[model samples]
Target: MVKTSKTVGRCEEFTANDVEVLGKAPLYQGFFSMVKYRFRHRLFAGGWSEPVDREMFERGHAAAMLPYDPVRDCVVMIEQFRVGAYAAGCAPWQLEIVAGIIEPEEVSEEVVRREAVEEAGLEVGELHKITRYLSSSGGCSETLDVFVGIADSRKADGIHGLPEEGEDIRVRGLSREQAYQWVESGKIENAASIIALQWLQLNYRKLQEAAQDLPLP
Candidate 1:
């Protein structure tokens, strides 16, 4: 076994300039694409490393929102069929937050609000940003922005989606505690859904305080 250093240096190489992109070749382009890249990066010890080649899946960025009504202490979640999960031999239908891809000219916040309406029939009010992260930097080039949006969760239960987009969604409302239990039970398996719900649990007191009055325009 190789023994590694127990201590590490400071993380100072924090920019694209640290790595050089030698070339990128498109492998496929459909709804999403695959690309091969050749590049090298600065070594932590000091010198630049050798060129390395890798392939990556490229689906554009997306925004996801968990609808919450602090006044009612409830949350909205959705269920939809995920082909990727089906292909992987997992359950084809997944429980997830309302989410949509960010179009080339659209912002994450706009996408989140639009998805809230299209997927759950909720008018997203004040959005509290939870986090932004790469879905899987090792293989996929998709960053996701997560938010908890203020909404009337009691009214958010129904089947809502755009048929033109081939979307069939079912919406459900659960008490905040029940939502978290679903997470712990592994029933809520989507990453964005899990993160958003966990964030709501952590910040619930603040959400209640904010909900005491209507958010301004």
Candidate 2:
């Protein structure tokens, strides 16, 4: 295989197409449909290679919120069960940043705010876009857009979720120090939550100082 990060591939005569399965093999009969998706192409100045077969999947995007209360020096996160992790031999339940899938025709920030309200029951104030990146590039094509949302963490309580969606999310708040300890102890296992907490830990002091400058609330 040729290795290059550039758009141009070394094999000039190469042409590829989406794989289509015409039949299923017996080995994977009961479990999965053994369908081969063939990508037919030729190498530059070389004979045609056998078509490459691979499974295809869709790409998805998610918006996550890190609810931060500068005055209280705390952050909010949610705990929920994840089917993907269970299937991957990991703990089925996980503590994660408030996140939701970006619906069709929906804006990223809107998704973040909606998720925060639904999962944590907090009205978002200032929203700071953190960063966007692929969650798992090797197998999954899922991109995550993360944000830091300012909110009142002290009053955060109650079980918040859309009953119609069968969501049983537990909303919880943690002090900056406690959150950092969780990160160090490997307790905040979720990637998005950990990243967001770390970011806040690095900037929490500055945020607290700024909050002090404001008039008494």
Candidate with maximal TM-score: 1
Model 1 residue runs over 4 Å out of place are: 1-11, 215-217
Whole-model Cα lDDT per candidate?
0.87, 0.74
lDDT of 1 by residue, 7-94 (tens): 4467554356667888999999998999999988777876678999999999999999998989889998898899988997777999
Q: List the residue pairs that clash in candidate 2.
A: none
Range of the 10 consecutive residues with the lowest summed lDDT in candidate 1 = 1-10
TM-score per candidate: 0.90, 0.73
For model 2, what is the alpha-carbon lDDT of residue 217?
23
Q: Best candidate, lDDT-wise?
A: 1
Superposing all C-alpha atoms, what RMSD in Å does each candidate have to the true structure?
5.1, 6.3
- Residue 41 C-alpha lDDT in model 1: 79
* lDDT tens per residue, model 2, 29-117: 33123333445444555555576655533345888989888987888878878887789777787778889889899988999889888
At residue 187, give the lDDT of candidate 2: 71
